[model samples]
Structures are given as structure tokens and as C-alpha cells.
Target: MKIALIGAGEVALCLATEFCKSEDEVVVLTSTVKPSLKDLKAEIRLTDYSVENLKKNLDDCDAVVSTLSGPNEFYISAHSNILEACRQSRKCKHFIPSEWNINIEDFPDQPMFSAATHEVVRNKLRSQNDIKWTMICHGWFMEYLLPTKKNPLREIGLAWAMNHGTKVFDMYADGLQKVTLTSTADAARAVLAVLRDSINTGADLPPVTHLAGQTLTYRDLFQLIRTRDPAWKSNPVTFVEVLTAIHEGLKANDALVAIHQMRIMGFTNANHNPKGKALEWGTGILQGLRATSVEEFLDQSEAGEDK
Candidate 1:
């Protein structure tokens, strides 16, 4: 299958690598191509994400997968154009939007980013029928726990829910809320599995697909960290504190509002646990695929550090 990836970021690169492993033709469209993208066995096309450009580029593609992400306006606009292009494409029928997080449908208008970006795309897709699309929600990326050198994900230092150096973590609703974590590589494999199944059975992909490498509460996660480092302290920000932080962050237009909101969603059971058809389908398709567990991920990180 000829697949067109709408962005050249780590997620898209991961997908390209996985798809290429099957010897499928992969074309990555991006405004700026990173050096790592050249290392992949895929064609890289430099182009703006305009509707006309995407339509022309995706004309012969069998599937379109977007991994684009940015500010609200840019993300919404780019995805809108990509969806329209897919609709008008001659052969492109399957599309996977850049929804690599939780089920935005469950919690509407929260986490400002989802409200502005994902919700807009969902609304657009609701009104369209030309393109068959599915949103893959894999909870949190386990890569965040590892350093950039140890993983394919780009580093965003100290922006994650856990701060190992400080021995502090966000305790969302008593730190008992279950949050799913999946490695990018594993998520990519699950996506390909779904696509293959859809093509083989001539069935439409589920509206939302959930893939979980490990699902554990913050308390459980802390215990795992303790297993690695016996001295690791658990200084957690209480649920009330998280709520207060979110409110204050929003008032000050703080970037941390998104993080706090994510914690709240997990606490509220709206984003953490995966259920229904989405979970069943993803788990069924990934039966034989051994997903990397949180324990395995920590072991890998430790091994990388030892080197």
C-alpha cells in the first residue's frame, strides 16, 4: 500500500519505519524535513499542508496518516486541509488523524488544546463521509519517561507528569486513577495491525482505537520507580493542588494548564482507562504482538544509562 504521512515528526517517522518494514511505499509530506527522516526508507516531499497541495500529493496514495501538531490554529487548519484533501483524493480512502492522546470525545472542551484542535477535527469528520478515518488513543507515551538518547521521541525536558530528579509526581485523585501508557514503537505496530485487518476484512476501522502498553495508577507507577531506585521519594501534588494549579495556570495563560488538565482527566476516569469496542479491537488485533511494558521500558532506560 502507498501511504502518505502528513508530518515528518517522530510519530510519523515511527509509522514510516513500521510501514516500510512491510515493504510498503511510504511518502512523508512536511514543510521542514529533519535529518533523521532521511535515514528512513521512505520518500520525503517538502510541501505546505494546503488543500490543493495535499490533494495533488495524495492523489495516488492508498492511505493518509497525519501526525501534525502545533498551536491551536495551525493544528486545526492543517488537519482540516488534510481531511478535505483526503476526501477529494482519487484513491486515498483511509485516514488516521493526529490524535495520539486520550479519547477527546469523552471529555469535550477541556485541556484547551483538545478543545481547540481535536474537537474541531472531530466535528469536521462527523460531517464528512468520503474518507474513512480513525483516531488512535494510546494514553501517554512511555517514551516521556526515557531520555531522548534512549528513545525516538524528541525531548521536552521536565514537562512530563513525573520529575525523577525532584522525586515529585502529580497525584491525580489519590494517585489511584489508572492511566494507560504505550511506547511509540508499539503504538505504531498496533496502528499497522489495525490497518491490515481493515484491508483484509474489508471493514471500516473503529472510530477510536485504544492501545495500552501498561495501565497503572500513579501510586503503582511510583512503586515501580521505587523498585528501580530504592531511595526514590514520592512527593506528590495532591488532587486539590492539581486543580488549583490548573485554575491558576489558566488565569495566567500558563503553558502548564495543559499538563494539569491531563492529570485531572486521568483522575476523573475520562482519559485513563480504555473500554468498549476501541479497547477490544485494539487488544484483539495486537494479541501476538508483545508490547513493551513499563517495567521493560525502565529496564531499557537503565541499560541505556549504564552504557
Candidate 2:
């Protein structure tokens, strides 16, 4: 399919990477469009952030996927520019807006719900009657659970960034809370799938299809880590203190509710299934990369205090 992708962020790059692998023609638009899809080796058309240039380029594409990050200053503006261009393009059929996080309707009043603004943009596109739209509502990215250079796991024994000594949050199920979390690759693949066939796809207007590597809590994750490393253990904390901290932070508008809802919902939906063969394909490539217990994650390098 002839596709035009907006924004060259992680999500956009990842999706473009997968779609390119599928041998589809993709055009990536960013502040400065790279010659080819970076790191993916696909023949991607590149365009800078020029509305006039994009309109002419996208005039013949079958679908347009907006992986633009949002609810922020630049993201909103860029999408608005893209929306107007798309409205006049006359050849685009499906417009997949950028909504890779929580369900927008779940928290209509919160600005962090990024979905709200996306809905507004989507409505604008649909009103033209020339473009159909689909929204991809994925839960938290499972990859977030694993530690990265920016978000390293807590040391081995002491609490890491968590309030109190609690290893897990309250919104999590009491014991066995099973929530789905899609791997970044899986999420990208699912978006590509929706782009391929927007007409007969997932759920309603939001096109709500949840994806995940697996449905397991922090405890489940801890257990997996323990199974891999017998030296790991837990340092428990109270739910009240953590929730109070979160409430205080968000109530003061110091923090957004996106993270709060992620813990609360804990990927709880069970009926959602992952689409796109590539999502599954990528999961296998990145599997077995994590095996650290919460205790070790928090205090492994801290004061070496796991007790």
C-alpha cells in the first residue's frame, strides 16, 4: 500500500520500519525527512515539515498514519498542519491518528489523555467526508517495565523512585492483577495492520484493540525474574503511601495521570488480541532480554540493602 507517515519519533520509526519490511511503499515526514527509513533499510520517501510539499507528496497514498507524539506544544501544531494538508490532498483514504497510549474516553477531562485532542483532529478529518479514520488504543508499552539507561531498575534492596518500600503500586490487582502490555514492536505492527485494512478492523470509532507481550503484574514480573535469578527477593511497601504520593503529584498538576492510569488499569483487559504478524515476529527477536527481580532492580546497586 502507498502510505504516508507523520513524525519520525520512536513509534513512527518503528512502525515505518515494520511496514517497510513488509515491502509496502512508505513515505516518512518529519522536521527533516531522512533519505530512507532510518535503521530499517526500506525505500522510504522523505519530506520535511512543509505543508505544501506534503500535500503534493501524499496525493496518491492509500493511507496516512500519524505517529506524531501529542498533547504537547509541537505535536499539536504539526498534526494540525498535517490535518489541513490531508483534507485537501483528495487521494488519501484512511487517516490513522496518533493514539498509542490509553483509551482517550476513559479520562475525558485529563489533558494527559492525549486521545482527547486526537479525537478532535480525527473529527476534523472525518468532517471532510473525503477521509475515513481509525484510532489505535494500545495499553502501556511492555518494554517500559524493563529498565533502560534513562529508566534504570532500582538498585538491589532499597526502594527505587517508588514511594515507601512497596515494590508494586495499588492500582495493580490485589495479588494476581493481569493486564496486557504491548511491546513497542508489537504496538507498531498492530498500527501497521490497522493501516493496511482500516475498513474491516478492530473495535468501534476508537478502534480499540489492546496488545501486549503478556498479561502479568509487577509481582508476576518479579516471579519471572526470581525464576531466572534465584538471588532476587522483595522489599514490600504500603499501597496507601504510594497512592497518596501519586494523588498529591497529579492533584497539584505536577504530574500527568497517564502513569497513574497505567498502574490502576494494569493492562486489565483480557479479551483484546494482538493483530499483525510482524508484532509477533519482533517479540521473538527481543525476548529473553529481561530477568531482573524488583528487589534487585531497586537495590542491586544502591546500598546493597535487599533486606
Q: Highest lDDT, which number?
A: 1
Q: What lDDT would each prediction earn against the true structure?
A: 0.75, 0.54
**By summed lDDT, which 10 consecutive residues of candidate 2 come out lowest?**
152-161
Which pairs of residues collide in candidate 1?
none
lDDT of 2 by residue, 183-261 (tens): 5555555665655545445322333444444545556666765665565555444455446756886878854445543
What TM-score, to 2 decimals, does candidate 2 have?
0.65
TM-score of each: 0.89, 0.65
Model 2 residue 131 distance off true place after TM-score fit, in angstroms: 1.6
Q: Over the stretch 246-299, how does candidate 1's per-residue lDDT look in tens digits?
A: 889989999867766766664665556464534443346766687788989888
Alpha carbon lDDT at 141, candidate 2: 53
Off by over 4 Å in 1: 148-151, 154-159, 275-284, 304-307
